[model samples]
Target: MNLENAQVQMRKGILEYCILHIISRGEVYASTMLEELTAAKIMVVEGTLYPLLTRLKNSGLLDYKWVESSSGPPRKYYILTESGRQFLSQLQTTWEELQFSVNEIVAKESKGE
Candidate 1:
């Protein structure tokens, strides 16, 4: 198995969760989101992000509003909907559980169990 492939798959699995968490904080623009993701080393391009944003909106998990920008055209700012908040809460719980489980297994293995 390719190590890089496995690492990429792992990152892909949590990308949406991370995105949701970011948007949940407050209304955010796509470019701002991209900068945050890049700063955190998630390294997503605009091509990947827009489609995911659309998918989340279509699924009723997110909504956006057009904001007039002084520099140029209006920008869409993403915000989490009620359903999105509930969904994110559940995902947070699952993330904690997975973290605990994985750490426990790794700890055991490291101890030569």
Candidate 2:
């Protein structure tokens, strides 16, 4: 199997969690979100981000409002909804548990046991 593909898939799997964390910090526009993700090495494109944003919006996990920009047309700034905040809290707990489990397994494997 392709290791690079696996790595990409792993990143994709955690994207929603990362996005929620970002939104939790504050309201964000798409370009800002893209820049943050790129800086974090997630390597996302608009094609990927827009659909995910739409899906989250439809699912009641995110909401947006248009803000006029001095440079051009209005921009949509996305923020997490109440439901989204609750869901993110749950995700955070799940992440902690999974991280602890994975670390334990990796430690054991590294010891050749």
Model 1 accuracy (lDDT, Cα): 0.94
Please give each candidate's TM-score: 0.94, 0.95
Per residue, candidate 1 scores C-alpha lDDT tens digits across 36-75 of 9899888789999999999999999999999999999999
**For model 1, where is the 10-residue window of minimal lDDT?**
104-113
Local distance difference test, each candidate: 0.94, 0.93
Top-lDDT structure, candidate number: 1
What is the TM-score (0 to 1) of candidate 2? 0.95
Least lDDT summed over 10 consecutive residues: which range in candidate 2? 104-113
Backbone clash count, each prediction separately: 0, 0
Error of 1 at 68 (Å): 0.6
